[model samples]
Target: MEVLVKDFPIDFVVTWVDGQDEAWLKKYNQYSQQDVLDVRNARFRDYGIFKYWFRAVEKYAPWVNHIYLVTDDQVPKWLNCNNPKITVIDHKQIVPHEYLPIFNSNAIELNIYKIDGLAEHFVYFNDDMFLNRKVKPIDFFSKRGLPRDTAGLNAIQPRYDFDYIHVNNMKIINTKFNKKDVMKKQFFKFLNIKNLELNIYTILLFFWPKFTRFFDLHYPYSIRKSTMKRVISENQNEYIQTMKDRFRSRHDITIWLVRYYALVTGNFSVRSPRVGKIYDLLTTFGEAKRDLTNGKHKMIVLNDDANISETEFDSIVKDLKNLFEKKLPIKTEFEKED
Candidate 1:
């Protein structure tokens, strides 16, 4: 099955932060008001890998129309800001003033659609996520402009206390659109439990056994700007409340909400990549390195986890730098010549 092709241009949006910047760190500390351990563990590791990220995109996904590098008043000194294809966006420009100095990624992500002149069809990427293979527009979207569904529901147990965010996301859909309720009434009558008090995860396990956490993909997310706008418009109060969260909270819904909304609305066509195509560097460094060395996968995510030892973390960074340099040694037009 193929989507009808159009002349639409696809843009790439990346959220990044330079934690080592003294000004940014001071601002974060002032707002965080937390101890060193809490602040340090807040997923703020700087492996100095943005250059490789750009290199990967330039090499494998050269068709990308524009690259929006979102940050908090900090730009990589080596980046070519003068490049017409690259734009540096400060958080203050998109996020509301009240949410200023925000350190939470969810807050920044929720407002990415507000970016001026962003394409209606865009791919959102984290600084740690990279394209590992040559790809075209079809890999991200169909010819009809619908995003390819690279995710499915899973029945894995929660790994963090904050996993309730996933539940909250489902509950929002259930309460607002009643999509889940409709599914329960039509397909899940076998359980025969009145007023099912179980959480969304348990309910999904019982009925749609394939429903998994949407976030495990850890790859670039193909998004429709208008869909996100409509979701926020319909759920204005909830959206505002979510944006107001200064830090990640159990009540806050994950940014994957847009993708979930797309799935439930049948706006996306499912396209599952082969197993082992996506790797999380922190936990699967060995496999990730092997995959990169062999050029086996289309995408890989280098998640920064503070729980790992400094030595191990440094080793991973060094190895990743070496691998990326080996694969993409030449700098693209996006970088300034040294």
Candidate 2:
């Protein structure tokens, strides 16, 4: 089962923004539609707990060869940019000049594979997602070098503006792959009983001849650098046009397209979805908090809601910071010493 990709050095990529940074806010407002961007927008709010994400990585996934902190030239005041294991990537470095000053994470993420010195095996993480339990390199990629993932079925039930992006990804995917053909060729892999929770969903969607949607997980996306490069190259025009967006747009295709491509092409290894879970910060605060403290999963996403008031959001963040401190108290080399 050995392969060259399995032996390649693995890197971790996480995109971050200091929503409170004046320079960043200025640029955000300049390009934002409201003449002034809403500083209180929950998506742009600076939750105080991001530091623990680095600490958790240091504690839980110490074997990660490098950690690339992708940002729009805004580094956290606490981040130790000089740390050898951490590289600060500016959007200008990977994205073309035309797409400079891009605030769209989808656009920035699409170009991460262009990172200097990035390895063949890499995983992309959102700031809110953290390595909760100790993990091995093999947890992300298999011995044969496929990205380990769960292939669960989900219909596009768009509840937010971003959900439409999944539909875009699906349209492109369905055009390139036949559902019936993929199912038959990769029957055992897709329906791998190891992922018992997904089997029922696969069976129920058996009649659908097209990929309506994939159960898009908020977990750190396990990606192959070559795969990303290939996906972008295949849909170059679509990506090029979409990358110009200064903010999230319904026209854009997401990184989930890469996952779907790999799944249909049988380039991924199946795993259980239970390894990581996403919990709402506003609606499931206690449940998410309890799971974090209990180390209930290997990864967790504190999915924030923009509808909550700033006061409530602040309180939740305050409590979350305390919980993370209790779990991963010691500061790592990634942070500046007080």
Candidate lDDT (C-alpha), each: 0.74, 0.85
Q: Which ten residues in a row have the lowest lDDT in candidate 1?
A: 190-199
lDDT, model 2, position 220: 94
Per-residue C-alpha lDDT of model 2 across residues 207-304, encoded as one tens digit per residue: 79788888777799999999999999999877986796767787788788889899889899988888898998889899998998999999999887
- RMSD from true fold, candidate 2: 2.2
Superposed model 1: Cα runs more than 4 Å off? 1-6, 34-42, 179-216, 275-278
TM-score of 1: 0.86
Q: Report model 2's TM-score to 2 decimal places.
A: 0.95
